[model samples]
Target chain A: MPRRSFELMETHIPSLRRYALVLLRHDEPLADDLVQDCLERAMSRWHLWRRPGNLRGWLFTILHNIYVNDVARAVARPDVVEIQDYFPAMAVPPNQADRIRLREVTAAIQELPDTQRQTLLLVTMEGFSYDETADITGVPIGTVMSRLSRAREKVRAASWGETRENGRRIT
Target chain B: MSDLPEIPTEDEIQALVDGRLDPARRAEVEAWLSENPDEAARVAELRDISGAVEQVYGHLLERPIPARFQNAAAPSMARSPVWRVAAMIVLVAMGAAGGWFANDAVGPGGDPNVNLARGAVKAHQMYAREVRHAVEVPASEEAHLVAWLSKRLDAPLRAPNLDVQGYRLVGGRLLPASDSGPAAQFMYEAESGERLTLYVEQNLTGGETAFRFTEYDDVSAFWWKDGPLAYVLIGRGGRDSLLTLARATYQELNP
Candidate 1:
């Protein structure tokens, strides 16, 4: 058995969890459960893990695949939730203004079409390079670039409280 | 080098904001930004959004690993509910005599304590990374977890209070302690999402104990035996940080 490789899988859990969280939009419990599923699959197929390349990217690709096949495939894409619901009702104020802004940013992120959100978080939050992000998301590098660019522009507009009508269309 | 690259494209600009731009092209982008105030501000906004996203969720990295994700070594070990409850009760009643038998069943290395420490660290590494199932039972059922784990390890188990240190009990889970017998892993999480695990197992034979510290991978674990229990405190922090928590655990349990 690939014993050392098994142990190495443990190291990637934190990053996988974070990526799962971002993809799931702050839904902590679901994100974590998804991570568990992803790790379980990776461990079972330890021999299949391509060494000398980006293991983190490989793990992420597995997670995104599971999500697409099992979860996202069933659940219809979620529409932008009420902006107020974006911020937890219990979140108190010293961070209130920032929280509200963050909520808007997240909602804008949530508002993104599924493909864009997936591409955007993989690049911006997880720090996956264009090539790696493309591999994980199973898209061309140019697509990853365009989706990320569009995602960023949307988030920028959201942060500034501008509506989509004011946003420029990307060619 | 003197020639300007075809007015760095939009993708190039986005690459700059994402920190993915090649250094060679980066200088061109910077020169481009310096010349264009509006575009620089846009890049600045993108950078802020990235920072805020990290700020919002970075703590997830530090949160305790849930029980469901702990045993990555054997995903099949996760049993159905009826089996889980029955196993919890039966494992404790059996008193890890099986593990004891297996201990001699395998060859011994020098210092049984070191072997125990290794088992402790292994358990720590596995369960400390979980989020949803960090513990076999959640803290809401604190009474049951204590009673169950106490019975299994055959030690009087009390969840240590590390409130002064800003760590609160998240929950505890049952772990196989290799040859030392079945062990209990108690998890605690700080407000900032940092986690610490205390691994407890029955000390089959009593001996004098002192704090012994070691590290595995990136995790630092401190273990010592006292009376009937051998304890290992593990976390991904410096030795000093783990020592402080280990000392706190010792005092709480010993007191």
Candidate 2:
């Protein structure tokens, strides 16, 4: 055990947690377990990590693969979620307007398709480049780009509601 | 759509927002964005969704680490692959300590520019997703934003206008610098929800210089120095697009 690798793994816990929370839709305990599983795998494979370009990206790739292979169905079931379910655990704003705004945005995100949601979250929220996202998701870079675009469009359309301007629905 | 030299494909626009386009093509896509406010705003909105996702879940990073993860220490003994295991045991015995493992993490590195770029990117990642609480002082208080950040930094700072580029000030916050001085970050957003951030710090010896681009992870930065203040414009766009914003910012701030 290099011990240093463990320290480095410690630094990445926050990132892994954030990614898992979003991916698992605010299920904190389940997200915790997923990150725990990820770290455990990384520990066992510490010697195999080939000190490459980005350890963060490598760790994310492993987590994503596990997510796809094992945890995808458990976490990504869209029909199971209702927008109202998003805020009970969160600190609700006292102001009604702010609460409404938060609800709309959260609902829009909750409505996104699974793959698009994952790709968009990884790219926009986590600051992963398209290449890094593709590597993590095991998809082509083109697929990552398209999924992000479609995902964003859907969220925008959902949050803003569609308005007709020049014969086209504008978000 | 009818008269432009070429319209960037939807994929290109997606790439533009993802900060993955190459320099040459980035300019073309940026030109398209500048010409099309509707498209630009839509792109900005798309970017905002990520911010929204981040805002909703970002607090997870601050939550206590679960015991299972915290307890997983690296294995002291390796039973597989005798040579590699022997090598690992030797290295552990030697106490080399990330000897060949550490590279390009956020820290005091060789290049000040790269370090600054990293800082800017990191701050951008941290707060750009915040909707109501993204900035310490909101854009509605622009005058106060400049005054407060300037006072804190002990250097004159301006929130560069990015209107022509279709990005408006989202607001700003004070950030602790890796060095002794303080740093400030100004976040801006296009109508579509794309965000670009300008990070300013007051400790550099270089005079006026050309824009240079660097990336840490997915965030891209375009930075330059004007006397003491170093300004870094970070966003999802590639070099050509970021260069355009950087030049516009430079002119506004310098003027």
Docking quality tier of candidate 1? incorrect
Tens-digit lDDT string for candidate 2 (B90-126): 1111112222113555358555755776677778988
lDDT of 1 by residue, B196-233 (tens): 88888888668846566666557777777777888888
Q: Which candidate's TM-score is highest? A: 1
Tell me the whole-model lDDT of each prediction, alpha carbons only. Answer: 0.70, 0.69
lDDT of 1 by residue, A23-90 (tens): 76665655765676676667766667767877888899988987876656544455555545433433
TM, chain A, every candidate: 0.78, 0.81
| Model 2: residues with Cα > 4 Å off, grouped in runs | A74-99, A163-171, B1-5, B19-27, B74-255
For model 2 chain B, give the 10-residue run with minimal summed lDDT: B85-94
Candidate 2 lDDT tens digits, A1-171:
546777888888899988877777766655665665677667778877887668899889878866776677544364534545544545532255445555667767667777887887788778887888998888898888778778877777767665413222212
Per-candidate TM-score against the hidden true structure: 0.52, 0.50
